[model samples]
Every structure is written in C-alpha cells, then in structure tokens.
Target chain A: MSSDVAVQIDRVGKRYGRHWALRDCTLSLPAGRIIALVGANGAGKTTLLHLAIGLMPPTEGSVSLLGTPLKPGRPQTLSQVGFVAQDHPLYRGFTVAEMLRYCRKTNTRFDQAGAEGRLRDLGIPLNRRTGRLSGGQQAQVALTLALAKQPRLLVLDEPVASLDPLARREFMKTLIAAVAETDVTVLLSSHVVTELERICDHMVLLRGGRVRLAGDIDDLLAGHRVLTGPRVDDAALDGLVTATHGERNSHLLVRQPATAPTHPRWEAHPVNLEELVLAYLEGQD
Target chain B: MLWVTWRQHRAALLTGLFLLAAVTVPTLVSGFAMHEEYRAAGIAACLTDPEARAGCAQLLDQFTAHYGQWGNRMIWVTFLPALIGAFVGAPLLAREFENGTWRFAFTQGVSRTRWLLTQLTVVGAAAAVLALACSVLFTWWRGPLDAMSSPMRTAAFTVSPGLVALTLFALALGLFAGVLLRRTVIAMGLTLAVYLTVRITLEETLRPHYLSPLVRTDAQKAADALPPTAWVVDEGLITTAGNRLSDGDERKILQQVYDGDTVREGGAALERYLAEHGLRHYTEYHPADRYPIMLIIEIGLYLGLAFALFAAAAYLVRRRTS
Candidate 1:
C-alpha cells in the first residue's frame, strides 16, 4: 500500500449473521482531501466506515489506516483517527466541561483548550449539560471532540443527516475551516450527492455492498461523456456506464479518455458530477 | 482513565456517600443511646456473672422488651448492599449502551478491557468501602443486642464485616446483569432479585453445612442450663436404651405417668417419673465463639463469587460486538 493513502481496504467483507453487510470491497482513499461516500440505505456505507476505523473487524479481508494495519481499540490507531458516528453520541448527563475533561484524560494527544475554544466560539457554554444543547450545537461539540484529537484521518458517518439546512451550512463551514487550518483527510458519507458536489474532491459510490464507482471527482467527470445518437449496439461504445434508448434514438453515458466521441454520427456532452453519480447508481438497477 | 471514570460516575458516587452519611448518623446516635441503656441495666455484668444473672433476669427482660425490636428492624440494612449494586453498579455499563454512547466511549484511545476494568475496580472498591462503613456502624449499633442474644443470628450476622463480601458480590452481579441485559431498569431489578435469592439460599441452606453442629448430652444433669449464646440446631430426649424419644412421645409418657395431672401440680412426681424412665436431654448446637471463623468463611465464599462475576463481565466486554 502507498504511504500517502490514508485508508486502504483490500477485499474486505463484513457479515452479520447470514447477511453480508459489505463484500469484496476494495478502495484506497488518498491523503489530505475530502472524499464523499454515497450509497443507498443498507448499501454498506456505514459498514465500510466502521471497518476503516477498526470499530468492527472484517470477517474475510484486511484494512489498514495510515500505512499501518487497523486494530480496533488500539491506542496508536485510535489516536491517529477520529470518528463521528451517525447520531453524534455524547454523555447526556455530563456538562460540556466534564466531557472535555473526559476526552482529555482518555486520549494522550487531545487538545483540550482547542476543543473548548471551538465550543466557546460557537457560544456553547462549558457548564451546560450536553443534553440541553440543540442538535446543531451537539454536532459541533462532537466535531470539536474529534478535531481535538489532531487525527490524520477523520471519518464522519452521516454527520449532517439530521441537521437543518442552516445547521448543515454551519457544520460545513466549521469543517472547511478545520480542513483549511490542518491537513486532515476527511471521509464523510451522505445520501445527497449535490450537497457534496462542490465540497468533496473525491468520491466513492457504493451500491448493493460493492463499489460501483470511485475516483477523483473531477477526473471521473472529465473522463465520461453523455452521447446522443441513433440506436446502436453495445459494441459501438468504448466504455458504456449506462444507456437510455428509444426506437429511433439513444443517449449513452460512457467513460473514455476525453470528453468527445470518435464517431461522426454521435454528439458528445460533458457530464456533471451529479449526472455521473446518478448514471452509475441507476445502472445498478 | 481515572478522571474519566470519576467524572462519569461522580453523581452516583456522591449520592452514595450522602446516603452513607444519612444511615451512619442515625446509627451513631441510636447506638450511643442503646449502649447507655445497656450499661444502666447492668446487662453485661449480669451476663458475665452467673450469680448476678439470676438476680438480673427481670431487669434484662425489661431492657430486651424495650430495645430488641430495633435489632429486628435492622434487617433492612441487609438490603442496602443490593441497593448500592442497583444504583452504582447497574448503570456503569447499561446506560452507555441504552443511550448509544458506547460508540463514542469504546472508540476512544482506551481499549474496552481498560475501560471496563477501570470502572469496575474504582466503583467496586468504593462499594466495598461503603459496605464496610455500614457494616462497622450497624455492628456497633447492634453490640448491646448481640450481647443479649448472639451474633450467629441473622439480624446481627448480615450486618457484620462479612457483609462487605456480599456487597461486593451484589456489585459484580449488577455489572454482569447490566452487560447481559443492556437495560438499566431491568438489570437493576434483576440484580436485586438475584442478590436476594443468593443471600437467602446461602443463609438458610448452605451456611449450616459449613461445619457440623456439636452435640452434648447429660443424664444426671438433664435440666442443666446450656450456654446462653449457642445456636441450638437440634434437641431431643434420649432413653437409657439408646433410643431417642420424640417430644410428643415424651410428653405422652409424662402425661401417663402423672395420670393426667399438670407438671406444676406434681413436680416431685414428674422428677421421679423421669428418673425411673432413665431419660436425658441431648442438644446439638454451633458454639457462639465460632462467630469469627464463620464470618471469615462467608466473606471468602461471597468474595470469591464477586471476583468471578467481575471476571465474567470483563470477558463479555472484551468479546462483545456492540
């Protein structure tokens, strides 16, 4: 595995009882960039994140983080990674100060004042009970805890799924600010690709427990073209990802070296990130 | 890890300390008064001096009638250990799982084994200390009453230092239930129920078998007074032929010998009838001096169970998927 890769999964599979949550999955997340993980519900997005963090071990294959093998609950691995689970779970009864102290004592690399300062900037009181905070404030505190660890790879599983539009914007603002201040590789999963189109530089699209598409976002868009032409057989297209055809006409989303098609009869249009993701997602059906 | 554990459980720990103070204050106050009353009644002198005991019986009876009921009421202290388990131990893990906070806790730099062991050690040690404090307080409070009867009795036995082991057992049982059940209320309820069952079963059926009861019989001195604090497990009338007589059969024989007359009405005739029958009283009892040895045995037994339970909880945590 490349030392520059933040997370590397090799033929990893996770099974819950008789059902496979993730199977035959392999990906290398590049360092120091925001990567978006997209999939439908139960499509194994959470399972992949959990495996990457060493929260749960893979039944079949191996996963490594930051060039070292992933071992769940290991001090070294956990110190290098920060994870924000789906609900952003915190101790409801504890005051914000107590929670900060808890993180400080439990983690050797914790930045206590930095976390408190983030909360302070957000106007979140240190003595306030965690349960009393709004959902947005709670999400910020959870993020603060993760950021305070000074992790190399930060894994967030649907951090903004439950937030309002304003909260989502604020969360993204804080995340972007944190990214700008530090060279942290972020991998976040979300259902809406449009929201991530501008923020994420890379993408991993999953469907039915498998990686359907994964690459640099700009590269993926630049390599694919939407060609409108007369009906043609599968042999006519160089790399067909998805196709929509009528009796007399056809529209094909195909991956190639450039944005143009070689055939004179075809008209090529550059695909956007949303269209590219949608094509692969629809192709799964 | 220590700060985190304390921070997480400070509220419960403080509340426990407050409760200890609450119980200890009253015991201290009432204990002093009861001791003063015992001294005024001269029960200790009466107990130690055989000649004075006969003269002080009426006075001792009055002291017991006034204060013995309080000793009976102290059985409630036996349940405090279980209560401590429910409040402090059950919530140790169950609350995290119930509120989905285990994801945050276990994902930290600390391993699950360290997390669990630290919590159990800190909380279990605190519980043992609290139980020890309560035991010392209640045992001191029961000193006069214990002198009146015996520490071997349930009312006094359950509050002795031996009960610290039972408290630790309760705490471990609560932790195991919390991990197994994963619901705070249900785990607390089950811990209490299970702790009570174990206590009752041990006291009633198991404790007596810890050692065999000693038997003593007298033929000429059939009516001699036994030690006042010996726990008499069994007593019977034996004939010269080595055949034991049931109480009912002995009563029947006395009735036939007296020709339906009451023993008080024909005391000399009753004595002559008993002599002619060659009968003597045989009593099997656990000596009161064995109290410390029994306490040590029970403490060892319950502490063994507590440590085993703690180890089981740690194992479950290490292997748990959630």
Candidate 2:
C-alpha cells in the first residue's frame, strides 16, 4: 500500500479452462526501478504481466496498480500503466504519424510533440506505413507510443525476443534513455538473462508458473554464494539453493548473509546474476 | 474513441459506400425511365376505373411483362445486408483479434467497453443509413410494378423499411460471430450462412402468417372477387360438406373438365361441372391495407434479433480476455 510500490500483485492466479498459467504469484514491484521478469517460454510471464496491467482480470486473487485495485477496462488504472504486448502489435495500414495520432486520440496524456521528436531523431519517416517499417523501427515506434503516454508504470512482455542483436541493443538504448528522463517504473520480461543483467537492478525469475527467486540483483548476489571444496554432502550447509559435484570436488550455491561464517576447508565466491538465476531455475527440477 | 473506430474501419466503410453508389447510379437512371413509362402509358387511370378493367388488364400485363423481371432481379439486392455483415461487421472485431491489435487498443486510456460501444455505434449507424437509402431507392424503383401486383410480396418487401432492420440484424450477427470465432474469414462465412437462413425462414415460411388471410367462397368463380392489390395466398375448390379440395384433386378435376380443349367455352363447362358436384371456389388473400402492419411486424422481429445479437457480442467482449 506504500506509494513506493508501483504494482502489488497478491496471490494472483490465471486459469485457462483446466490449466493454471499463473498461480499464487505475489510480488511488490517498487517504483522508479527497472525490474526484469526472467522466464522461459510458457512460464506464465505474459499472464502475470497482463494481470498487472489490467489487460485481463486475475481469476483467483487481486492486483493493485499504483495503490488502487486493478480493473480491466477501467480508464483510471489503464491510463496509469502503459503496456507493450509481445511482438509490439501495431496497425499495419497506418502510417507512423497516424499511429502516433491514434495513440494520442486514445490516451488522455499523450506526448505528441515528444513522440514525434523521438521518431524524427531516430530517422523514422512519419509518412511510412508501419507495415513497411523494419522490425527494429517498428519496435522503436511501439516503445515510443507507450512512453509518450507518460505512464507511471511501463510493462513490456518479451519486448526484444524477435529483434536481431544490434536492433536489440538500439531498442534497449532508447528504453534506457527514456527511463533516465522520467520517473516511470519498468517491468520487462525476457528469457535471455545476460542482456537483462546490464539494465535491470531488480529481478524475478519464474519457473513452471511460479516465482523461483526474486530480489535486488546486488542483494541476491550478496546473499547467495558459490562454494567449492573437497567432495561433501550438501545437507550440512544451511540455506542451500543448488549443488553440483565431481569426483574430486563439489560446488554448492547457497543463500546466506554475506558475512556468514563458512567451513574452514571451503572457498566461497560471490554469485553473479546469471549464475544465481540459473542455479535456482535448475534447482527446481 | 470515435476517431480510433473510424480510422480502423474507414476502409470497410468506404468500400460499403462504393458499393452503394455502384448499385444506386444505375438504379436511379432506370428508375426515372420506368416512372416516365408508367405515366405515359396511363396505367394509373386503368387501376381506378372499374369499367376500364378490361382494357387496363392488357396494359397492366404489358407493363408487368416488360418490368416484372427487372423487379424480380432486384431480389439480389437482398444480399446487401449479408454482404455488409460479412465484410464490414465480421472484420470489425475479427481483424483486431487476428492482427493482435486488440492488445494495443484495449490497454489505452479508454476502457474496452467504451471502445467497443463507439465502434458499434459508428459502424452500425453507417450500415443502417446505407440500408435506409437502399430501401428508399428500391421502393421508388419498384413503384410501377407494385401497382400491377402487390408490394406485400417477397421481391417488393425485401426493399421496404424492413430492410433496415434486417441489415442491422445481419451486422449484429456478424459482430457476434466475429467475437465468438476470432477469425475474420470464418466469421464472414458463418455470418452469410446464418443471415441467409434467418432471412429465408422469415420471408418464405413466416411472412404470410403475420395476419390470417381473408377467405371468400363463391358458387361461381368471380374474377373480381379479390381486389387488384390483394396478395393471393391460396385458391381452391370447397365442397358443401366444408371440405377443401387438395391442389392435386383440383388439378385432376380441371383436366377431366377441359379434356385437352383450349377454348373459352371450356371454362363454362368446368364451372357447370363444379356447380353440379356441390363444389364452390374459395380464395384466401391479404388485402393491401395489411402492408403497414406486416411491415411493422417484420421490422420488429429483425430489430429484436439484432438487439439480442448486439448484447451477446458486448457480453463476449467484456468476458473474453484474449
């Protein structure tokens, strides 16, 4: 309920007929931070993002955006949260300027001049139909539209999944530049871990429709340690996350305070974001 | 929201306008020529003068033979509503889902319900206006033929004010099918099939029963027993025992009476035989005055169905997430 919490999802669940795509998912995404939602395909990342943005109602629990209850089709909640669905869907027949105009007409607080300027700076022609734009240009246009809404929270679902690496870098550069200029909180989902590590300060890893690990990247790294020592059973260590062993030695990833005492024979090293996320994801199965 | 709806559907709307003009220009030119011929031929005087019925019958027959097939060909215009439903209504929502722009549209500052309502209003109003225009044009086009027979018949009725309601119903059906199926092409196909079925059922099976026919029995078959504008529902022989002869029995009796003869004298002999057999000729008809009541009833039926379909489409839009 704090003003610092941009989105608070409590015990939310989404069901598709007999299957539950997301269940018992609870998270409080802090305002003004770039949060990465890391998950593989069909891991309920899209479902959770949709529920948070009020694109669809949660079947079981509640979602609160900017301290108010999330209601699908409620103008107040919808205006406060901007969303870019997967593939950055756009009207193919509309010119880029017309797409901008359409966004302006549909939203209450659209930054028309700012969006036009952004496109102009990017060398994207205003009169070109969106269908004719390159994949990267289309992504940039979709992002521009979402940002120009001046939303309090921005949600993107697998935004760069289909873009080539160079385009992906450019898309991230535009996104980061916009974030620097606004107080908007961002929550973007992706399966690729390394790309997110550079931009995201906070992280949530999902596995099999459940949150596997969530926290500040620095805090998660500080808490989890990778220990290597002579072959030993993992049962002795407290807060064990995952363990792998060879004939001569064993390695364990454990969650514990950074200053915690360790075994005299073992050497402990700080866990990186990718290693921490992958350890928990692999630990699940 | 209005601008959004217009921008998204302007192509379909313009296509509808182009089609309307395509049909209207020819109809307007031909309609003027037909009206000129009707006046020049003095068909109006024959309709009013009772003694003139003899000469008028021949003039009327000539007028009808010349333009009757033209009026009947206008029945193809009945497909206008179905086409509107298929191209305009079906693609209205189906394309959104098909192209996945619904996600972009619904997540904006406007609510989903408002967005949908705006679309329905703009598109529905455009369709209704086009249908009204068609009704006006065709009603005027078929005016000469209507005087020769009855406008209460299928070909004439399809172009009446009832067309407005039927068009709205078709559009609503398309909208509902689009939301249900989520595929534009499939929804269009479904809309055509369903629209034709409902239209045919109402026109062929249910139209006559809107009001009970007026029945008259005569010992002699009087040619002028029914009015000129009366819609003849059924005509047959009735026995003194109150039994109506089936069409097959009447055909067999007519064959026996005529005996392959093709002379006016054979009609007198057929009448004499019917009188001797205690059989009377019966005519069942709907008078011209019933046209207004029939129009009102048919319009009410289609509007009611349209209302139901629009409600169903709205409900699905609210309930379905993807």
Evaluated with DockQ, which candidate comes out highest?
Answer: 2
The candidate maximizing TM-score is 2
Error of 2 at A37 (Å): 1.0
TM-score of every model versus the real structure: 0.88, 0.95
Q: How do the candidates score on chain B by TM-score?
A: 0.88, 0.94
lDDT of each residue in A162-234, candidate 2, tens digit only:
9999999999999999998678999999978888998998899888888888888888888889988998864
DockQ of 1: 0.64
Task: Assess each prediction's global lDDT (C-alpha) against the native.
Answer: 0.85, 0.89
Fnat measured on candidate 1: 0.81
- Range of the 10 consecutive residues with the lowest summed lDDT in candidate 1 chain B: B218-227
lDDT of 1 by residue, B59-88 (tens): 988888877887788898888788878987
Considering only N, C-alpha and C atoms within 3 Å, which residue pairs clash in candidate 1?
none
Evaluate candidate 1 and give its CAPRI docking class based on DockQ.
medium
Chain A TM-score values, per prediction: 0.93, 0.96
